[model samples]
Target: MEWFKVVAFVVCVLPTAHCASDAIVWCYHLPSCNDKTWPTISPQYCNGSRQSPINIVSASATPNNNLTKFTFVKYDDTSAMTSIENTGDTVKVTFKSGVKISGGDLSEQYDSLQFHLHWGNGSSVPGSEHTVDGKRYPMELHIVNSKSSYNGNTSLAVKDSTGLAALGFFIEVREAAHEMI
Candidate 1:
């Protein structure tokens, strides 16, 4: 009789544990960027004194052979607005249809769907990479792309890593900028 009760309890509780949704929990010791506070210290911002400064020189410059050099003029434009949403610990930005990035040694024009930032949740230390004087950058921005021949089927490419091409840019947070939460 006791064994039957124990088996019943286990069966009842097991499904509940597995049914819970998986979510990324961000531990914020400071206020987040979306918080409506006045100049509060955020874990995403690094103060000037406690941060690592990046120094660049002209001698170590190398031209990018894989990237397309096109002027992106729709940083704040609404027409270029794509789908921006939070995915786990990172925020994803997807561009509108027919927004193409070209001008490199490639035969096909790559479409810009979205750009996302992968960062650590602390000041003076971001979860990214940057390069200075031929060194790797502390933070890197990945501009994910797919072949334009697919006709705006980037979602299908994301499912397959081989079908996707990504361009990375290293950046550092100098001051308190608008955080894309």
Candidate 2:
């Protein structure tokens, strides 16, 4: 069987988490810090408001007609990505200063921070983090942003519930074939 690529520009806006980390050792696959031990390993994230893997009840959703197109600042310059690093989890890219986003139902303009890609080895059932109809893509990109009001102060930004925004993009790798007749 050949690989099927996923290509979708899914923009879901919601109150999400902050990009704050500490000395506490936690991970996605490690036995000590996996889901089974998350409560004991990171009690703060296991609390009432931070629970993940939530089910979205589309039946109860209300359309927001006020959502306007996003305004991107300094993105056309092509120098937005300042640097890149591999954090053992994924490939991270730090966006250049001044690149920002506004409108699109966002309360305030969000300054571009960094983005990363999460991928899984070619697996049959489980492939990527973003899924549709139980089908997973090959890779997912997360563009992290903080409210411009924070002024690059990560510590302060992490305090507010709506301080951060993550733009998720799903990418799929397709297999092309050429054969001799």
Candidate 3:
């Protein structure tokens, strides 16, 4: 099995009450709230150095022997995925608990929370949030997981640096096999 090539990007939007992100609505696609002003959408996350690593230079990646195979629990259960919606910026999928993931050098198992797809809002735009060799993929998928130790309490998970994981997968169109020959 192909191990998770990219594991974990800290998520920083949990609150003690009423859910963390319920209060603020971020306009991610607008020029007024682009990259430079993204932090304005959530200033609370900027005070620390522990949020998501927005991007990574693949060429600079270091090989780790430890990030081995991962065991997926209940990934096939369609019921695990509870909801899906368009948040204006991206399409997000919510999970119904029980699905979990382990191995991949993790000291403990992580609960599979949800996943979202990153694709162009329009046919003319590039969709993927990440790039390979300076080119963006047609689409991308981010699977968010939180350490089970937190007991589904996102408020607690957001504080720990290693409490959350964001697995990313780039979707690409395959070339015709006969054409290759």
Candidate 4:
């Protein structure tokens, strides 16, 4: 609900349609509704037992040998670029056709919908969603996917458990940027 307000503010306040990252910062770090004040937004955010971006405690994690290794289908295949747009909140890349992900705790294959980036202004502070042992990353990449069980109906799939999945990666700053960037 509050995100919509930020979107409107960017559209009205900025001369151009584009929204600077600084404006987005204010929305996320809102004094009344933030990570610390998540309960104010919704009970699900803080009060609920199920939550995301949780700290992964390695010591308590148990590895399962039966888990299969992850595999991607048609991932390297060359395809025509669909569209790339800056949606004020995030820069997103869309593809005409999606790649299928199989294995690694997934009983059913999932197809990629889109990929988005979360980053800060290149500061020492981190801006990623998830943290490891309470340590955050400066940037994060999330490849969203929906299970084949959905039959291509993302809207319906989202409401069901195990209908969606997201592959996340930490982006560490380096001396040279990747060619893909």
Candidate 5:
């Protein structure tokens, strides 16, 4: 009887161990979003003094007159999407050099690379990476761009401090679906 119990434990634990551990390592879902474990899995996720999803306080924000207003060039042009996919965490759309942005405080111009959306499970749960006064929105959109100097090499650009730029905006919940949908 004892031998049978030992065999049962091994059968149940050994085969399923890999599945349970892999889920946490790959997804890093809500259960493992803690500070303690996340840094262990991906150091980059927690590295650097500045972290994503920062809490922005509008009242305390300061405006710099040195920064000029930005200009969007050819942003309205119709272009075909190169790719769209669900990355388990978010849905992303890729474009082929359709738009560019210049001016503002940017030292160099940038071109649109891709856009992605982050969403929570339900209305009650906040999903936006950046919060306003510690508030979270149900959904957020991020348009990623890389500096024009990189010549469309996002991989190389991402390594530089000025290489990558991400514009994020919140999507408020509506009583009914919007006409744009």
Candidate 6:
């Protein structure tokens, strides 16, 4: 009975294993791994069904009139842009009043809240979701905002991934700069 069971298990598994094909693998490019510089690594798997990268070759690619544009207006209050300082793994930023970002499909005017930087431990890696030309930037800034424009309202835009929009700035910090936090 034991011999029959083993034979049955193998018979059922062997064909399925043979019929399975490889899968497209995705990986993040980080600045460092295990406190050391991140090494160039290839994807773990490759298969024929993998999707190809799209490149718009048409020169006529233009913005449609129906498309909403998000306008980032520079407020005269320099204080809104200040107060950004790196603290270990995180960077904090504060915005002053009269600073507003509008346009696009925004249902309400967004007011700046505490923003932070998310990045890998090294220079080579970028800690963000979207990559440019498969290359990672050194750091990514997440300028968090609130749609309600009021504090202690329990309306954190960051809490809802689909409900909020984030302005991501990919930066390469090569030198130190004085800023507020």
- Top-lDDT candidate index: 2
Q: Which is superior by lDDT, 5 or 6?
A: 5
- Relative to the true structure, how large is the alpha-carbon lDDT of every model? 0.46, 0.67, 0.65, 0.58, 0.59, 0.44
Of candidate 2, the 10-residue stretch with the lowest lDDT total is 12-21
Any residue pairs clashing in model 4, and if so which?
none
TM-score of each: 0.47, 0.74, 0.72, 0.72, 0.71, 0.46
Candidate 1 lowest-lDDT run of ten: 4-13
Clashes of 3: 3
Candidate 3 lDDT over residue span 1-181, tens digit each: 2222232332232222211356666443456764346466677643334343245567787776877687899999867788899877688988888899887766689998989877764455556665655666666788888899999996677666567766777776554445433
Query: lDDT tens digits, residues 1-181, model 2?
Result: 3554546544444333421346665455455555456666666655444433233344665678988887888878787889999886789999888999888778899998998887777753234455555555677777778889999996776667777767776677765675547
The clash count of every prediction, one per candidate, is 14, 2, 3, 0, 1, 5
Q: Give the C-alpha miss distance for residue 65 in model 6, angstroms.
A: 6.3
**49-124 per-residue lDDT for model 5 (tens digits):** 4445467787997876766766766667666467999977689988777577766666778887788886676654
Candidate 2: the clashing residue pairs are 6-172, 80-96
Candidate 6 C-alpha lDDT tens digits along 1-181: 1110100000000111111223512334434332122122222222212111112223644554654766555555665665777754577887765466666555667665556765676645545433454544555666655564544242343344323445666565443344546
Order the candidates by lDDT, highest first: 2, 3, 5, 4, 1, 6
Instruction: Give the TM-score comparing model 5 with the true structure, all chains together.
Output: 0.71
lDDT of 4 by residue, 1-181 (tens): 1110110000001111111232233234445644555544554324543445457666987776867877887778677236788978678976455677778676688877777876776553347666667766667777777787786787665565566777777666544333443
Model 4 backbone overlap count: 0
TM accuracy, model 2:
0.74
**Which segments of candidate 4 are over 4 A away from where they belong?**
1-27, 44-47, 175-181
lDDT of 1 by residue, 30-106 (tens): 34632122123333333222222233445865666665465443445677865888876578888877666554444
